[model samples]
Target: MKSYHLIKKKKNYNHKFLNTTFCDKDKIRQAFPFTALIGQTNMKLALILNVIDPRIGGVMSMGDRGTGKSTVVRSLVDLLPEIQVVNEDPFNSHPNNFDLMSQNVKELKKKGDKIYTNFIKTPMVDLPLGATEDRVCGTIDIEKALLDGTKAFEPGLLAKANRGILYVDEVNLLDDHLVDILLDSAAGGWNTVEREGVSIVHPARFILIGSGNPEEGELRPQLLDRFGMHVRIKTIKDPISRVKIVERRSQFDRFASNFLIEYQYLQDFLKNRIINARGSLKEIKIDYQYKVNIAELCSNLNIDGLRGDIVTNRAVKAFVALNSRKSVIDKDIFTVISLSLIHRLKKNPLESIDSNQNIIKTFKSIFGYS
Candidate 1:
């Protein structure tokens, strides 16, 4: 018989290896997988849709402490796909979205050869409550300006979070100045600076994510309206499910190394699903009636301004996207309204007498959902 090594057919060597650097290893290490999180279904759903379509502003989770509010927010990292960005760009600018590039950078791009793209893991920059205004909005390098007669705009958290997620823990406690800066940047999707005689503006578009306990303090109305979606998370009361959570956590901790190895495939599988959902969002359609219903609900609820309508529409679109649907439907609109509008209601002292019942009654009458 011929030798096996010589007789075996040779495999083709032309296939290219996929650049896996987009896979955010650091994010994964920092956050637990969404699938691994137990309970908080509504919170998880809102977050899922937001990640699938960042235009839904971003999700705000408010609830009791240790109720997995923060846990769910952090877990989002594992569900996102990697992104392509310009090499050496501090803002993580997409090589294709040149419209958002700065004037100087745009000119540079015209003169330079074709801009090269590099794969980077999607980012989720956390904005701590204690951060200062200067740190958040960025400061100029005075020394460099004086010595070299050149102005260098140091990027802030918003710049770093471009085309990615900006998570704020205990957002209600953030300083007023910082809140104003965040709100301004979030509203226009760009940050304009006119300080130290150095004028600069750059794209600061990012998904604004926040989680906090209501007991600490209430978020400002102006800032609250900026969020696209709001979710309330409560402690799991079921004995069995609670037990399972403990057991699962214990099992993972006991076999940390082996557990991660075994679950890597599962994590990647979820990431792929999210990527597919994002692609599906663009193809999904919405009917005029759905828009009318959204408007009616907001109007009846006495929601201020047109932001609620916009957020409601975006939330429904995101929900449909997550379902991989071709068009928006009544059910999608209703579900989104419940999650996005409940926390946003202007509290009435009279309504507070039986808030839950009154809210449910109104919802049933309007949307006819049980």
Candidate 2:
């Protein structure tokens, strides 16, 4: 059987990978299957939860290099369903969206020529270390203004990345000013650009994914709290697991097609689960006792604000949805509470204990081991 991870089947094509790229790109970039990664279970779970529900806030992964952090984030691009966008529109605007789409798009639709659409692969763009404000927020088209005597807006990374993932590597090292912009857009789901007294606003709702080594630098508390969940990664400690990791990478390097074929079934299973979970999220049950349990845990941990309780609710629900279940249970909350609340807890100056350990202790105190 053909590997679904490698190329787009005829059934799923829309002929607009980048909307204006030379041709399809699914064949060019070969991402490792999400189901095939070794270890780092918590980190992988955090990524999957965010994919299932972006409102849980995007996840942050901080750990050592060569732990498959970037690989995991990029692999997620493969598992997402294609998004609909107005054809020939650079911003990838949703249909019938005049307020956020370009004026050209609005005019084209007004002419009633049966506006076409393309179901393109969702984007997963990188936020480079040296990206400028205009580069991230877009800028005014100076040459168009000077020559055509008309104003044009140049879409940037954020524009290309609407309804997609904005991954920032070494996130702790990103400039603080840019961090502020990320926080604002992440919270508001809109990116407004003002330059030369001209302003532009468009949909910028994307999951903010960042991976870095904390030893390089510390993430600001303000920004840290903004992440829906955070997890630490480490190299495999078991000798067999390490050897298997090497074997898998070697197989992928030497025979990518075969490697993908080996895991295509597993990948398809995960992809379907995510798709179904999204459709059923509204109907998934949320018990009040579960809410009290999450609130109690966050409160006892001294995690400030209601963000913890809020994120925990979303995460737990997604967790249940991921398991193909329709309701929340005490054990379901246990599975996600640490990931949701650990990053939100206030840190003590002299405490070396990790937040997950503290969360486990609290879990035992409240619900006892499960």
Candidate 3:
């Protein structure tokens, strides 16, 4: 088993894979397996759906720390199949996916050469809290210009994360300015750079996954709204369940070298399910009743905007697709509504609130959830 650590320098760092082959075997073993994690079904489901449908904005995991928040994210890479990426493309955009690599194509055409295509696996890049604007957004290559008198644009994390996951651990602690950058890029699915006499734009679309302890600080409402799904995870309280979690984790760490091989089938199963679900998602139909129910729920809960309704609808559709269901049902709607709406419902400090339970009960009564 090997230990994996992200080594960062001024504007560059070693690119290492947690589960991939590296000289240090112990680092890879240090990563907890996603399959061994217990409970937190909502968190797991949110992550799974986001992988299947990156269109669902991204997932936010808010809870106390040391509850395996980061572990679940790292382990997800093991579950996802490697994605094809363009070789030598700074942004790592898949050459085959022209829609996502349009900007790259334009740049290549300007250079008077036909762009060739190559494939690479999807990567999960972490955005550390202390990262600077230059590091995150890329900066001019002064040395390259000094040596060749030609401007060179260095790609940033956003570029590297293209067509992959951009994970921000303890995201609430990140600077507001950085958050704004992320929000703008994520909203548009592209990052445009026009500073330092360099104008460059490339595909920056990615699945934004964030985790933090809400007790430390509440995420800004504006940023909070950006997340398509919010899941609250807490340490399992049942002694038996807790013990089982510890045992499984211990066994995985003890046999880190063989852990992935043993669970390779299970990982492939989950990956295939996600891939198939994405295709099937387009076929799931939402009835007028479901729409009305969603709208009514939002209105009843006094949710701020139409985004909630949209996310709730998409989540229900994805949930049904995951289960291979052809149509959205009352139960599916109820479950999504609960998962998507509960975290957003505002609480009144003056009044004692049990809104979560109340909403669930009301939804059950309205939708006849058994």
Specify the highest-lDDT model's number. 2
How close is every model to the real structure, measured as TM-score? Answer: 0.87, 0.87, 0.86
lDDT of 1 by residue, 1-370 (tens): 4566444422112122123422333323555567787888888888888888777777788889988787788778767778888777887776666855755567668888577778877788999888887677777887788789887878889888888888899988888778778777876789877676777788888888888899999888777877888877788889999998888777665655555666788878877777888888778777886777677777777888887788777777777776767887777776777677766678877654453455456666776676
lDDT of 3 by residue, 160-205 (tens): 8888899999999999889888877877898877764656677889
Residue range 178-252, candidate 2, lDDT tens digits: 988987887788888876666777778789999899889989887899999998888778999999989998888
RMSD of 2: 7.6
Model 3 regions more than 4 Å off: 1-30, 107-115, 141-151, 368-370
- Model 3: how far is 269 from its true place, Å? 1.2
Positional deviation of residue 323's Cα in model 2 after best superposition, in angstroms: 1.3
Between candidates 1 and 3, the TM-score winner: 1
Q: Give the TM-score of candidate 2.
A: 0.87
Q: What is the C-alpha lDDT of each candidate?
A: 0.76, 0.83, 0.79
